[model samples]
Target: MRRFCSVMLAGVIAGLGVGIGVKAHAQAAPLEVRVVVVTTFELGQDRGDMPGEFQHWVERYPLEQSFPAPGTEHGVLRYNAQDHVLGLVSGEGPSHMAAAITALALDPRFDLRHAYFILAGIAGVNPYKASLGSAAWARYVVNGGAAHLIDSREIPADWPDGFTPLQGHVPDEYPRPPLHSIAGDMAYQLRPSLVQWAYERTKAITLPDNAALQAHRHAYQDFPEALKPPHVMIGDTISSETYWLGARMNRWAERWVSYWTDHQGEMVTTAEEDIALCQALALQAKAGRVDAQRILILRTASNFDMPPTAITPATMLANAAHEENLPGLHAATDAAYRVASPIVRHLATDWARYKEHVP
Candidate 1:
């Protein structure tokens, strides 16, 4: 009986040791991530009901794991463990985007050192460049909000508009001796090779079109590009917190992008969060938490930044306020997923090939 009791005690000790070892292993190693899909907002429940920028990814990729994401607009982050893909909603504006991205990057449960990030969302497209539902891969993301603004009525008659670059007395003035020395926060230039690769791969995709979209495009009869069917293109994005509209603002967006990129970028998509998102990612890259070169910004056209000739900007803005039934909303969301998913899948499935060298 004494021998039997001693053997039982020994067995219990061994089991306890194994349990502790497993727990320690789990605590020391974080989950490896391949790709992270970042979206701006969602309309309702993730699975059922109306779709937004995030719904298609969640339901289609079918992210099966839920991890608590404190301090984010959405309380939880979705994960597909099999594919090693994670989905995040950064809310609608710059503030929310900064907070959500920072929170995700700092989370202890994720290993993001080599993970690729894709910011896929909808934006107001420049009718002169692309039509509704078109997907654009941005090469440069310029901040339109970081400017010196004066009342249009009070500006000099010779000036183009009240907007000017920071520390500049006039519009479009080059502030520094070397243009490349401009503040890092003013703009983010993406890898041209990677941008070209993505654009080439997805440029031929045919985006969805309907009677409403057809009728809407017809209003922009003067703009040839707006009348064409939705397709993928390489364009730049301008981000501002204030949702400004009209022809004047459109022209400003074009000029802003040109000034920041030294005439290399053409503004196609206007959004509210990309600049802040980039800022956060850049900081994380500095901290050795992520790879900045692996970032990609994809925006689909949900609406036109300027109104048609027949309507005034005020009227168009008012109409857009009731965007739940907007015709381009669904098309843009679908296009974002269609255009971005191919790259995501390629990276996640062929991790061995792309883990060290970005393809």
Candidate 2:
């Protein structure tokens, strides 16, 4: 039914002035390959080092784009191996990152069965509970910087906690609490089942021969049980523009003005593109395109929000080099993969069996 529906939809789209290639995309029920890993930044250890790593890996997969394959601007490597089709898209920021994920998910040929969206980049943290290298997952991603203030005049007189009655309530500068979304629930809820599947499958399957895969496998098996439901806060928080201005300024409250000018917010957290991806996956799951249980989101922290003078190159370098920080990220990334991989394998196996029965 799904295949028939998609094929019909593709035909309709094609007939309506859409390109022929796109119309032919629905010939089959889209490939139900396992495990699509996405990274906003490069698959490298740091911001400056992602391109080389990205370039080296793209060599493994043949690309469909006209431009030169991976290593070039926004080059992609799409492939299917061991029943799992993987996509590697590079660069950062929300708009680009979101588009990349959507592209990978919507590509009818790839059959992206189960997706693991790993926001593999650095992030700013609370600095106290969250250190430089600690791996935090977002149970609740708060959209801090993107909120609009509801003016006192526009607000009703009886809304709970409404500021209309306050003495100093400025009509223009009303404060509003931030909005939050539960990001990792789709991913987090699957952890235990995934881990169980991992242990069961480890005995029968041969692990991948790739260096990153092997390292990832080892890291997955060793994941600490305490760190479930990883906290990933997505927002514009870090900037170098304020680095030089630290010492000259005495008043700290005014420092936010400089950062807001550049980064657009003081510091906030929200899911990168997980919300939209989750929505898409939910649709796919309902349509029986992918196993909902096999999906997960893994993210790594990069930095901490601090006074301008506090953040130095040396500080960032030290944070990056900090044993706890990098190891935690490596561990968390590995943990997520370790758990999700087998669940993906299980779903793929089931899908393959189902395909055999289709005839």
Candidate 3:
């Protein structure tokens, strides 16, 4: 009986050791991500052939490991284990982006506490501010769709395209209700110092230019900025689910961005997902899952927000629908990767310094 009792005790102790080992392994399973590259969509497979927002990062980094992201749009996340870099596709629009980013942030498999997020994507450029294929580092991302709207035909003649701030009496109304009282999350302001640093680091990048892109720019001869070659610049983004085009809507976008940022932001790139992505990141930051200040938004112009001189909005839409790809699609994608890769590499390689202090 004494021998049997001793054996039983030994067996219990061994089981306890196994339990502790399993717990330790689980705790160590989570990846310590240093940098996250967030793209809005992927064309087909992650590699080979035509590149989408996610392809260049995938092929260039050679992300060899893949993990299932059940709820995300692409349903998978790519990882470069050696560099501790993650590539994610948040889907195409605001809803998809929010869901995917939120899911990723909440996942226990990734330790994002100190991770830097780079949202690189393509957008419609404001012809007056930027040319096709130009890249812009955003200082502010404003939600252009969060407002009261009236049909243009029914709106007061004095009103501009029938868009007004929530609970405001007029278009671009000021001294408005406090943010929390109304739709408080109308705009997200990134760290200006970081944005400036990124801009300075990449402003000299020469974007891809070809005869086709040049011809597109020539059509916008009236707009001096649109006629220039593709280049990197510091600008702001306006995000709306609706793909709006026309001079009147462009004016509305300009006003909306200016109003939300108190005239500190100029509308350069118009996109659909950045504001939603920012909102998710902000919430995750509040939850202590990620660092909001480390997020960088880079948008390259794939097309113009408004039709070029003499081209009607309907005609431009028709042309776009028939084309296999936008005029600046390739150029914009190349520029986005070229401009953002340096920052991503620096942060991932020198993580010891950036993990403690955001550069």
Best by lDDT: 1
What ordering of candidates by TM-score runs from best to worst?
Answer: 3, 1, 2
TM-score of each prediction:
0.92, 0.43, 0.93
Model 3 is weakest, by summed lDDT over 10 consecutive residues, at 18-27
Off by over 4 Å in 2: 1-30, 43-73, 83-85, 113-119, 150-294, 307-359
- Candidate 3 lDDT over 4-29, as tens digits, reads 88667666866777434433553567
- Over 305-347, each residue of candidate 1 has an lDDT whose tens digit, in order, gives 9998979999998889655755599999999999999988888
Which candidate leads in TM-score?
3
- Candidate 1 residue 48 Cα shift, in angstroms, is 1.0
Any runs in candidate 3 off by more than 4 Å, and if so which? 1-20, 179-183
Report the backbone clash tally of model 1: 0
- True-structure lDDT of candidate 1: 0.89
- lDDT string for model 2 (260-282, tens) is 23323322212244444444555
Which candidate do you rate higher for TM-score, 1 or 3?
3
